[model samples]
Target: MSVFVTVLSLSSLATILAALVSLADYHLNDYGVCTININGGTRTVDVNGGSSILSSLAKHKIFIPSACGGKATCGLCKVTMVDTISPVLPTEEPYLTAKEIEGGVRLACQVKVKRDLEILIPGEFLTVSQYQAKVEKITKLTYDIKKFRLRLLDPAQMEFKAGQYVQVDSKLYGAVREEVSRAYSISSAPSDRKAIELVVRLVPGGICTTFLHEHVKVGDKLTLAGPFGEFYLREGADHLIFIAGGSGLAPIRPMILDILKRKLDKKMTFFFGAVSRKDLFYVDYFRDLEARYPNFTYIPALSGAKPEDEWDGEEGLITEVVARNISDPEGKQAYLCGSPGMIDAALGTLREIGIGAEHIYYDKF
Candidate 1:
């Protein structure tokens, strides 16, 4: 009984000390308001110091694409520090390349704002706005993939290019105690300004994806921010080659629709890779488009088709199918979206087939 009492007393003392230290640090590290200079003084925001650049900018309504919230994991919230050169944290080393580091690019989530900062933000990021949206519909596209249709409520409209992406915010649910943000490409066409569609594949332990797939329901309110990424179509290429797999189809779908709606003269060939027929979605949609539009063609390739699949389409890796189909790369530009491994392999294959590196544009998730 005496030993138990003594241990309790010690634990109380430790807790008191920890609280005192936290209080002291809170008071001592209270940096006053600091100014954030953006894009050579194109804009500036004054924010309280001692918070991360990511959260600080977010508080001021400047949204950056961060799939991992502000946890320094996604490495998507990168901003170029123009005047201040800070040490890169160990968490940021794996995401940044030597060239990026040399260019003073730092993960905004990892950088604490203690003083005034001068940074370069992309022109597109300046246009992004937060929105209150309602989950209008949810459609099961595959065993692990679902399509979420979000209708903007607060601001009834969003202007974005066909291939841009948006960041969806998730509430804490079940075992997840922290809110998270994830980036998903908009699958709906730009013509539909009132709503957007996101194609999400359930990652085994993904925080945002799991929340979206399981906890989110139709009519539930959600907060999202948007119109990020530079994966949209570029003009001047008469022949466009699109290659994607899984949820990578999100952005390409809109691009294809936009092109067809505009009645563009460009010839489009889409190569969709999947493990089997079960993994494929929007096949009929693209096939209908192909039948109506002579300039468009849809090719779904199965790399690992099972006997039960009864698949008789193109059988091989996506890269191999692309190589087999395309003989001439002249006046052709390629847009690819998929896993990093698939993108890297496609890059090599496209290069071998005489596609210029400048003509190959990709968005890797």
Candidate 2:
């Protein structure tokens, strides 16, 4: 009788939770339609309120760079609201700094547009689009890294700067589970223009990486959105050093290709660091790049090489190789993309090698 009562209580609790979830989905997230005023009434949008301002704009085809896909982990989708908001959500608290809160900046994903709002986002976001695409090819680049070529099926192709990244919406694996979109840097050159390619390294149990590696196949249709990021090359840097590891190579490759194609005569060095020989990829491609440009060099370093590897290049930590290669970092700017630890190490190594904080630029993965 006690077990039966406990079972009944559990069932009742679940039913109540389901009902509340349904209610919130209906009432808190369904403000049929509303309007948004932007830049002092210079622009207006008739959008649905109740979903996050981020998602509502996205539903209408505005692309914001959110690494967490609205879970609010990346803190990329920040918007300034001059008008009132519902309240600060718990999910946004960690990502929000104190000054940001004081300035009326909120995580777009966490804020529901319950009423008409005036918000501030990048102008580039106004141009980003949502596309229906088909996976055309999937080829392994390294043991852990795979290259994916996606062809847009709907409004075919995209116009974007070389260093931007797009968010890939994950499809269900087996059960009827909803998946979040994951962002990755665009690897294909802008010259390709018609198709998109991404370099994805297999992450052990990562939700999106595992799905892309194990379940997705060629010809599978996927919904993707936007070329978003501010990691592109800024003018006036006469000398540039690009550093990357693992899948961080994606954005830097495209940026280099873009610079090369434009016939820009700039001194540049690309340092790619990996763990072993198998971990290294893109050697021949970068070799070709070096042949075409006199002022460019692609240096690949393996930190842990085996006896059979027969390697004689730089050894030890990647930061050590960086410090040895670039003797005078005083005048140059650097771009780093990798794990947070690696970025921190590189930034410290760069500064130790006499690079100013102002001369270093980074996009940490």
Query: Model 1 over residues 263-327: C-alpha lDDT tens digits?
Result: 99999999999998899999999999999999999999999999999998999999999999998
The positional error of residue 243 in candidate 2, measured at the CA in angstroms, is 0.5
Against the true structure, candidate 1 reaches a TM-score of: 0.91
Best by TM-score: 1
Regions of model 2 farther than 4 Å from truth: 1-32, 84-87
Whole-structure CA lDDT of model 2: 0.84
lDDT of 2 at 171: 81
- Weakest ten-residue segment in model 2 by summed lDDT: 356-365
Instruction: Please report the TM-score between candidate 2 and the true structure.
Output: 0.88
Pairs that collide in candidate 1 are: none
Model 1, stretches more than 4 Å misplaced?
1-27
TM-score of each: 0.91, 0.88
